[model samples]
Target: MTSSAPRRTVLAAALAAAAGAATPSAQAADAARTSEASAPAATPQAAARRSKSLVDYHSWTTTTDWHKGRAQGTGITHGARPGIHIVHPVGTLDYKDPHTGRTTTWDYAVWTSPAHSLKVPATEVIASWNAHTPPATWIAVELRGTYSDGGHTPWYVMGRWTAGDGASDIRRTSVDDQKDGRSSVSTDTFAIDAPAGGLRLTSYQLRLTLHRKPGTPLTPTVWRVGAMGSDLPDRFEVPASRPGQVGRELVVPRYSQEIHKGQYPEYDNGGEAWCSPTSSQMIIEYWGRKPTQQQLSWVNPDYADPQVCHAARHTFDYQYEGCGNWPFNAAYAATYRDLQGIVTRLTSLTDLEHLIHAGLPVITSQSFLKTELDGAGYGTAGHLMTVIGFTKNGDIVANDPASPDNAAVRRIYKRRQFENIWLRTKRYDAKGQVKSGSGGVCYLYFPAKPAPTQHRVLAELGIH
Candidate 1:
């Protein structure tokens, strides 16, 4: 387990455990609803895996490089004073065509990483980008992992990000890339190869390639490029749930994003895009803090939820084009004095249970239809909700921002249903049928240097 390949082995083991578990349908439901059976215990193997040695996390952004301008490329222009743009090219290329004609030339632009290194052994890799009014174009990312002896992995194609019609909306692409020759799409993690007498990973680099379609008036613009890796610890199993088990519910005031639905039509017209910010607002206020007047001053005075609006504006990723940017939301929480945050995945509600028991609330992501997740009464393409505590019968108590009003935000849902959706190891629909999205993403915010137990968990997960 000392080499880079160990990371993939760990993930494979988790997938194995997931595949082996027999998911009971109707019987499992009867048991949970009847308050009869406790959650199945984790097998010995899974427990051992959960206690494996911890890794570390690091990241680099557009600001990491020394050069502040755009990299060299054709049809490239300085994007909006400090950004990068790929303009449409007017000419065609005849060399590749055989029939009646020539193929149109494509505009290209790139951003290369500096010769930077990491102290800890790196694991998986992930990236996020922001752009405005992107045209029909393809984006390819290349990554390299270097060892102490200078041996490195090839410029592996991290993946391709593409946009067809929407120009200004932000799209958060997951680590699972549409591999185009350089890397395998089957695996999301990357390990630096340690050839015999070679080296261990010490440094890494990233490059972004933008492909703009020819003969279009619109250009593909980029605001920022962020890259990181699979640094979260692998904990495949969660502790069993017990009926009537409850934790001290941290009092987080709730605000309904629905209230701002039509107030700011520009900011994704508000509600659909305000969940992340509203959830952050609740967590920040729970810690006895509030956005300063200056932050809210720009908000329209007539808007009832000014702070929610403030959070949206503050956390919006200009290029990603929305308030749902995960890292951006967590970073916004860090801006409050005496607070620190990181985006990481938890094994299950058992992990959440541990945090809630220790007096911390967690923000988690899940998407479901109204039928799939009972009490919610509606479905979302994707949504963010805060885990406040568990009911005595092991049900979920949450501050669901999707409520129609602030007073209606607190909600309780069946334990099994809630955990299944919140975990995001896979996807589920409104009727509780499995669907497409993967889960395990969460946001954690607390005082700088959390308590020992909390710190140990975060440390093991390679989170801040």
Candidate 2:
């Protein structure tokens, strides 16, 4: 389609004008406070019903979780943030970086998690992680899944990541062209080739390969690793949700992608394709974290919002050649100090309301025709935007990055329109061919230590 939306649309003349846009704890007394703050005012049964069944999220975060994995030259750390790390080199491999065509030898260690059965058989899965990759170190995340029919999938590379973009580090990217006849890896998602055929992913295992310079003590520390498996029903529309937080817009800074259209073409042709990182930057800063001046010094002095450019460069997926890789954007957000990010699916707008109500902004991915979302002006095969809050009438107030300038980035989209466009799994393209929707894929960034209320809400949403 000819449009300005990031990653998936072609540039159009209209884009030049369109560019716009938690807590607590305590012991016995703490228990009472936690219940009061976390439980909805309605009833405990209501809270139970709120737990969704369309999606299942599983992760390995604690030392116990690490021990459950079959480790080869890997060891678990003990502390407030337990993790798996390379204790000894198990082998060596020569990696040829496609982006730079540079070959380098690195020592590596492997940790394979035990198979995790999904609560719901899923048609799609997206993996995410939080890690500290010091200079010359990085980690690769791979997944192997079992189909409901008892067929097994080959180990698929979900991402090859590093927190840094320096010469010593390999370009963080998603493996492309990875597919079997039954399933495929598109960017960062593992999806069944034909869900309508009655095939589903019943279980899966994650494999982490930690890489570092040969003979060096450097090792990547992985704090968290997990995936979200979902099987959302195919629908052209979703049920509308009642507004809960009316007139509660959070003050989030804005940056327009259209304005930086040609700033850094090497990173997916600059801002025209930078919605993922741009949206990520907004939430990263919303939590009081941002790239330091030193980190942003590489950008041309003339470009505005160099931080956005910085974000784009860091979150760029060389293989996919775009910044819209979901897990990469979340990984980029976690690079900021004291922050954690994850890629997950929310079942409804009420899930968003819970986070926004707890003072969190969400970065959501969606695809729609021009007629599907009013005020968008242009249609997109895919796009990313920050859901800042709700309008008095329950509409969505978003920091849409596809605007003409920073001031024009704030937009209020219709509630039912926004929800359907975001939550639906199937939609008709401009040519009327069926295309996949994001199914409520979102990037959630929050502090490592959240307030009690924020913690409660996040836990309620199955994030903790």
Task: Give the winner by TM-score.
Answer: 2
List, residue by residue over 1-464, the lDDT tens digit for candidate 2.
Answer: 11123332211111111222123112212333443465354347536754546888788987888999999999997787788899998999999999889999999999999999998899889999999899999999999999999999999999999988788989998887777888878778888776766789999999999999988888998888999998877777788788874666766778788888988888887788788888888887777677889888898999889999999888888887877888888887777776788999999888887677667778998888889889989888888999988888889999999988999999999999999999986677788766667789898887777766667777766677
Across 256-349, the per-residue lDDT of candidate 1 in tens digits comes to: 8888787665554566557778888887776656777876777889888798887776665433356665655665675565565556556556
Clash count, predicted structure 2: 18
TM-score, prediction 1? 0.56
Q: All candidates' lDDT scores?
A: 0.55, 0.81
Model 2 alpha-carbon miss at residue 210, Å: 0.3
Candidate 1 local Cα displacement, residue 207, angstroms: 11
